[model samples]
Target chain A: MTAVAAFAWSVLQDALHRKVFYAILAFSLLLMLLIPMLPSASVGVQVDLLREAALGLTSIMAFLLAVIMASTIIPGELGRRTLYNTLSRPVRRWQYYLGKFIGIMAVVAIALLVSLVVLLILVGAKFGTFNPGLAKAIFTIFLEAMVLASVAMLASVYLSPLVCILLAGLFYVACHVKGDFLYRAMTDSTNHALLRGLSGFLYYILPNLERMNINETIAHSERVFRVGAGELVLLSAIALVFSAIFIALGAYLFERRDL
Target chain B: MEAVLSVEELHKAYRTRLGGPRRQALSGLSFTVPRNSVVGLLGPNGAGKTTTLKCVMGLVRPDAGKVSLFGRDGDAVEARRRVGFLPEQPYFDLYLTPRKLLHYYGRLSGMGASSARSRISYLLNLVGMEDDADLTMDKFSKGMLQRIGLAQALLAEPELLILDEPSSGLDPLGKLEMRDVLKSLGTGGTTILLSSHQLSEIEEICDRVIIIHRGREVASGRLDELLEEKGDCEVLLAEPAPGATSGLPSSASWAEDSGGKRLTVSREELSAALTALIESGASIAEVRSRRLSLEEFFVRRIGKTGWEVEE
Candidate 1:
């Protein structure tokens, strides 16, 4: 456990020093700050639109942070040959793998926290009100990003960073639309039997990431349907389970790999 | 005597690329490091020295045999706890200072904060990096990094140290300092297994050597014993008298001179050669069995044709 924590701390320190991490954070905050200048739909719903836009920007920021860090950390260490120092110690491969994953999560968490504060200040200065419920949406965004990062990290153990990013992106899109597009494809008689079978198989295997996108709901002050505490807990559990599975499999493969 | 580390019949093969044929890196390699002794692993390029060290450290798995550290399986965590390793040309994160990096490794090695601090201080001073301990490694030279690598490997005060090319990238002065450090460690009762291409360095510091060619052990013994020319004696003379050549035995042959004339003969004919020199009124200088330098011994065993062609 100490070994894992040490590696995680090293990752956190290393990530903080990188220029790319700051570049992504600054770009997203700049976009969020520019949200108020867009064309308005109505005077009453302008604040809601601004919150939705801010949340959308935040989601992109979190996803980029997670996927980029998870995809590059292991491969970068291996390429630099720094991993030989750490892995040669009295530490297990699983500890190193888990620590790196945790470190990526820590970076994502810090980035999201900073972005959330920026979003709150922007909303307060522009609209003269506080939307405390925004925390719920941000929490869901973090959960969703963890899932994405885990899957990307698993792919990173076997593929390059660019390929892992692409695969994770494809996975995100497929999983997000599974509840809607996959259902339609599975039930539509116009589709071929093999296509329907494949769709059904994918829908059953992949998580419904679309359910975790409650940005609009919380951004609009829960005017339609609110995310209750019980639902949030259930959703978090599901994401945690999936992330564990991905991490376990990734560690297993990493352990067997010759360094 | 118990061996601190032993490798028996180890074998490994690596694929050049995807779908490529496997190339043998180690073929039935075997050697052992006696407790508290410094043993050099000597080889030319592609002799599997690095592969053998990697296998001993559990970084790579051997296909055929076993490596035991302190009489336990090499891959066991408990066995590795007593070991330290420095890889060839090790790299570290540039943003970290040596102090911070050593602290991190110390924690992983299960050292408490106070003990780790003292050990880190001692090692930094020992490796001559005390002044630059707090500086980030981004601007460090190759030799500076090598020193830090040694410091990190010594952080936990391991019982056994395995170093690959420790003198690599060092200047003459730095290489001398490294030799002194390794010699002191061996005297302090730490077992060492060193892999190097520098035959002189090995000859200077190692008590014994394991010479490998084509991933197999060709010779293993005390350095002096391995370099001794069997059944051969060298005789030296100050000056030869007239007709001294006819008085010599048929087995005697003239050898090279370094400010003195020398001759090589069978060990059995040393007495006859000396008597012949005396009878001819030629002053006798020194007589001893012939011995080759480490370089000559290596070439003699490996041959003029490189191991690459043979492999």
Candidate 2:
């Protein structure tokens, strides 16, 4: 556990020094600050639009931070030969993998929290109301980012960062669209048997990432339906299960990989 | 002697990119480092020295065979707890100061914060980086990084130290200091398995050497035993004598240096050569069996063909 924490701390320190990390964070913050510049709408609808846009920006920031950090940390360490020093110690490979993943999430969480605070302040000053409900959307964004990070990190074990990023992007798109496209393709009698079978397998296997996106609902003050505690717990469970599977598989592959 | 580390029948092959043929990195390589012994792992480029070290360190998985550390399975984290390693050209995140980096590694090695703090200070001084300990490593030279690498490897006060090219990238003075440090550690009973291309450094510090070629062991043993050339004797004169070779046998060859005149002859001709020297009025200083230098021994073992091919 000490080794794991140390590795996690090292990743945090490493990420703090990376220009890309700050670049992404700064860019997201800059966009959020510019939210007031959007064309003026009615007083009520304008605030909702601002909240929605701000939450969307926060999600993108959190996801980008998680995926980029996860995708680059391992390969960068390997390329720099720093893994030789760290892994040569009395630490297990799984501990290192878990620590790095946790570190990536920690960074993403910090980024999300900062965005949440900024969004709250912006809404309070601009519209005279603190929509603290935005926290729900940010929390879900974090959960979804956890899944994306795990997937990116798993691919990072065998693929370059560019390839890993591209693959994770494709995975994100597929998981979000699978609920509609895949379900239709699976039941369409016009499709071939093998294609339908694959679609069915994918539809069942891949988590419905779209379900995790409550940004619009929360941003609009949950006018349609409240995101209950039960739903949050279920979302947490799904995210945890998928992240565990990807991370476990990644650790297994990393164990047998040559440094 | 009890062995601190042992590898048996280790084999590793790396697949070429794009599904090309596999390149054998280690082929049934085997050796043991006895407790408190400093053994040099010497090999040419692509001779699997690094791969063998990585296998023992658990950084690389062997295709077949076993590595045991402290008489336990090498894969066990406990087995590596007593070991420290400095890989060739050790690297670290440049943003970390030496103190921070060592603290991090010290934690990884299971050292408490307070103990690690003191140990870090001691090591920074020992490696002559105390003044620069707080500075980020980005500005550090390769030699400085190597020093920090050694410091981290020693942070745990490990029973065994495995170093790959420990003196790599160091200036002449740095190399000498590193040699002295390693020599002291060896004398203090820290077992070390050092892999290096610097034969001179190995000769100066290692008590024994294991030379490998083409992923196989060519020769290995104590330095004196391996370098000893049987059936050969060298006689040294007390002073330079141009006339020393006047009555020497045709098989005897003599060279002059600041020390004196030195003659090398086959064991069969030693008596005749000494008699000739005595009759020629040469003052004898010493007479002993001739021993090859480490470089000569390595060349002989690895062969000229191996040399040309590596080049």
What TM-score, computed on C-alpha atoms, does each candidate reach? Answer: 0.96, 0.97
- How well is each residue in B28-119 modelled by candidate 1, as lDDT tens digits? 99999999888999988999999999899877888899999999999888888999999999999989999999999999899999999999
In candidate 1 chain A, where is summed lDDT lowest over 10 consecutive residues? A250-259
Global CA lDDT computed for model 2: 0.91
Model 2, C-alpha of A238: deviation from truth (Å)? 0.5
lDDT tens readout by residue for model 2, B154-175:
9999999999999999999999
Interface RMSD of 2: 0.7
Q: What are the per-model DockQ values?
A: 0.82, 0.91
Cα lDDT tens digits for candidate 2, A228-251: 889999999999999999999999
Judged by DockQ cut-offs, the docking class of candidate 2 is high
Native-referenced Cα lDDT, model 1? 0.90
In TM-score terms, candidate 2 sits at 0.97
Clashes of each: 0, 0
Per-residue error at A71 for model 2, in Å? 0.5
For all candidates in order, the CA lDDT equals 0.90, 0.91
Best by lDDT: 2
RMSD after CA superposition, every candidate: 2.1, 2.0
